[model samples]
Target: MGLFDNAVPGGNITKPLMIALGALLVGKMLSGKSAEQPQEAPAPAPTPAGTTSADGGLLGGLGGLLDKLRDAGHGNVADSWVGTGQNQSINPGDLGSALGPAVIREIAQRTGMNEQELLQQLSTALPGIVDKLTPNGQVPQQHQVASAFNS
Candidate 1:
């Protein structure tokens, strides 16, 4: 399947929603690189927990994040973020519980927004972005997300 398979019909670009996805991926890549590099000097600030540096790790971690949502009794909402369909609304309160403090805080830092504002943005954007990522109605692999970035 093509990248952005779940984008809005009529070929609308999903770029705006990519913010959360991009932040998650960047968290993974940056953390992974630091892990690989044996830094002798004072270590850089770590990426938040629940993030990894591997290319696919970000998507996988996001899938896990969705799972957390489901496990938190929001399966229907989580499912809405997966396929190319009308994305259901997500409650920021619920999303916050699923994302955890560290991850949320880190994302806020990465996006240069305050936590409350970041949460609001994420609640609005994540479903569409994740739907775009999982064009095949399933979680995409690392390379797929990478190719999407390049494309």
Candidate 2:
């Protein structure tokens, strides 16, 4: 009988042995080709120029100065309403008004939120917005004064 025919039908012996022999043949062929292939060497890292490294101290000092300036500005606004006894709600627009249009626009752009929505969130988060803008913790009367003078 032939090599495969000697094995019983539906037996595990012939099938597994054939598969393993085929796999070994393929492995041998691939390994022979891989051994003749040339391997590429890794490139060396680039060296940084200049004698002194970049100074982060200057940037840190500038950042600190900016923080101090921001704190001072907020403090000034808070101080403006220290004696005010009014309970008026501060809106988003009020905060924007206190900070100016440029700052309000910048904040809106950076946060990816609408100006009105940002204003509303700030109004809820920081009730101090109204107090800082007005003596009575309400919308400031400056708008009316400006309108009157303009008209």
Best prediction by lDDT: 1
- Give me the displacement of residue 102 in model 1, in angstroms: 0.8
Residue range with the least summed lDDT across 10 consecutive positions in model 2: 50-59
Report every candidate's CA lDDT. 0.60, 0.32
Q: Can you give the TM-score per candidate against the true fold? A: 0.67, 0.29
> Scored by Cα lDDT, where does model 2 land?
0.32
Residue ranges of candidate 2 with Cα displaced over 4 Å: 1-88, 128-151
Give the per-residue lDDT of model 1 (tens digit) for 28-144. Answer: 434333332343222334655665553433324566667777888888887877865668888888888776787777555544567887777677666766787777679766666
Residue-level lDDT of model 2, residues 27-125, one tens digit each, is 121222223223411221121221111121111122221232245354443443333653334445555555455444533443345777766655443
Quality of model 1 by C-alpha lDDT: 0.60
Query: What lDDT does candidate 1 reach at residue 85?
Result: 67
